[model samples]
Target: MRTHGWRGQPPSDADEARARILTATRTRLSEAGTTSTSEVAELIGVTRQTVYRYFPTTGDLLNAAAADAVIGLEAQLIKHVVEHLARTGGDAADAAVEIVAYVYEHLRDDPALNRLMAPGRISSTVAGLTTPSAIALGRDWLAHFPVDWEAVGLVGEAQAEFVEHLLRTLQSFVVDPGEPARSGAELRAYLQRWLAPALRR
Candidate 1:
C-alpha cells in the first residue's frame, strides 16, 4: 500500500529543478490548454534553455508528465486497494468493490483526475491511464493476489476474463458516475455469484 511520489532519496538540485519544470507544465496545462517550454520556464523563473535541458521538446514534456502521473495513479490505486482488501478479508469481489469506490472517490477529489475526466480536458496523461496499457497494468497489479486463485479453480482463462471484466466495469463506472448501474457492493455480490464458479474450475 506504499504510495510513491516525487519524494525519495533526498532529491538533488537537478531533480528538484526537473520536478519544478514538470509541476509548471502540469499547472500550465491545467490552467491553459496550450503550454510551451518558454511559458513554463517563465512561470518557474528559469531560462528556457534550462527547461529544454530537462525536456528537449513539448512532446518530451508531455510524455514525461504522462508517465509520472500514471505512475502516481497506479500507486494510489495500489494503496487504496490494499487497505480495502485488508479490511474485507482480501476477497476478490470485495477488492473489486473497494477499487471501484476508491476510483470514484479519487475522481471526485483529485483535481488532476477531475481535469482528466472532464469533458475536452483529455490529454496524454488521461489517455495513458485510461488506455488498454493502464488497464493491463491494473490487472497485473491484481494478479499478485494473496488469495489462491488456483486453489479456488479460477485459474487460466477464467481468471483472465474475470479480471478484464472487473477492470472494465470499474472504468465504465468512473466515466459515467451519474448513471452508475449498481453500487460497488452490489457489483461485488454479482461478481461473486458468477465468478466463484469459474474459480472453482
Candidate 2:
C-alpha cells in the first residue's frame, strides 16, 4: 500500500486508513456529540491534510461516520424483519409494518443516530437518506429480508420501487414527524393499515 507521508507508521492500505478515520470520528462523536476532521486526524495520529484527502469536508466525514455507525443497526433491522416474517408466516404486509415500526423506534432511541438527526445536522442526514446511494442501500437492505418478492409478484423494478417508497416513508417520519407522533402499537397499526394494502396490491 502506498504510504501517505505520516508522522508515524501509516495504515497498511487506503481502506484501513479510511476505516481508522471513520472509527476515530465515531469515537469523538460519541464522546462529545460532534466531531471535526482535525479531531479525527489527531485521534488517528494523522494530519488534517491526510484526513481531508479522504473526506474533503467535515460534512463528508460526518456522513461517512454516520453511515459506518449504521452498519450494525442495518444488520439488526434485517434480522428483526426476518424474524417478524417468520413469526407472521411470511406475511409481507405485516412484516413491512413491523420493519417500519422497528426502524422508527430505533432511530428515535439510538443516541448516535439521534445526534446525526439533531437540529442543524439534518441537512447531511437528509442528503444521505435521499441520495441514490441511499436508494441502493435500501434495495440491498430489502433484498436481505427473506421476503417472498416473487410470490408477491414484486420483482425487478417493482421490488426496487417498493424499497424506495418504504425508504421515503421512513425518511418523512424521521425528518418531520407528524402531529401527535405515533409510537409502539399505534405506529405499527397505522403502518399496517396504510401500508399493507399497498403491499397486497
Candidate 3:
C-alpha cells in the first residue's frame, strides 16, 4: 500500500512511478556518473522492492534511461542538421556527414550512452539499434530530413540499409575507434569523404 515514490508525494499510477524512477536514474547518472536501484529508491523515497518491481535489474534501468536519452539527443541532432543545411545550402550528402560526425563526437562524451554501450554491453546496444523499434525510430527521424532519397535511388529496402549502415558505422567508431583515432576536423573530413558518398547513392 506504500505509494510514495518521490519525497512524500506518491506517483498517481504505475506509469508515473516508472517515469519518476527514470527521472531519478537520469539525475543520479548526471551527478554520480552512475546509479543503482538502491540510490534511485532513496532519491524517490521508495523501497528497493518498488524499484525492482519496475526494473528487474540495473541493466534494465540503465537501458531504459539510455534509450530515452538517445531519442532526445537524436532529435536534437536532426534539428541541428536541418537548420545547418538550410543555412549552408548543403545537400543530403553533407547532411549525412554532419549527422555521423555529430553522433560520433557526442556519443563518445555522453555518460549515460557510454554506460549503455560499454564493452561487454555492446550486444545490448547493437540489438537496440537493429531491432524493429530502432529501425522505426530511425526511419521516422530520417523521413523528416530534406534528403531526396528517391533521387539518389535510395528508396524502399535501400533506405533501410542506409540507416542500418549509418548506425553500424557509428557503433564501430564508438566501440573501437580504430588503431589511430580520428577527431575534430580530421574525423569530420573523413566522414565527409567516406560517408557522404554512400549517402549520395
Best by TM-score: 3
Q: Which stretches of candidate 1 lie over 4 Å from their true place?
A: 1-17, 23-44, 52-63, 88-90, 118-132, 179-201
Residue-level error in angstroms, candidate 2, position 184: 4.1
TM-score of 3: 0.82
Ranking by TM-score: 3, 2, 1
lDDT (tens digit, per residue) of candidate 2 on 89-188: 8577887777767877877765457767878877777667767777788778877877777788778878778777787778888887778887688888
Clashing residue pairs in candidate 1 (N, C-alpha, C atoms within 3 angstroms)? 152-199, 153-199, 154-199
Candidates in order, TM-scores: namely 0.59, 0.70, 0.82
Q: How accurate locally is residue 129 in candidate 3, as Cα lDDT from 0 to 100?
A: 64
Model with the higher lDDT, candidate 1 or 2 = 2
Please identify model 2 stretches exceeding 4 Å from their true place: 1-10, 45-50, 70-73, 87-90, 105-137
**Runs in model 3 with CA error above 4 Å?**
127-136, 199-201
Task: Give the per-residue lDDT of model 1 (tens digit) for 1-201.
Answer: 111232333235777777877887878777875578888877877667767777898768766665566567667888777776777676655565556566656555544445555556544433454466665666687765455555555566665665666556556556555555556566556556754444443
Candidate number with the higher lDDT (1 or 3): 3
lDDT of 3 at 59: 87
**Candidate 1 Cα deviation (angstroms), residue 125:** 8.7
**Alpha-carbon error at 11 in model 1, in Å?**
8.1
- Lowest-lDDT window of 10 residues in candidate 3? 126-135
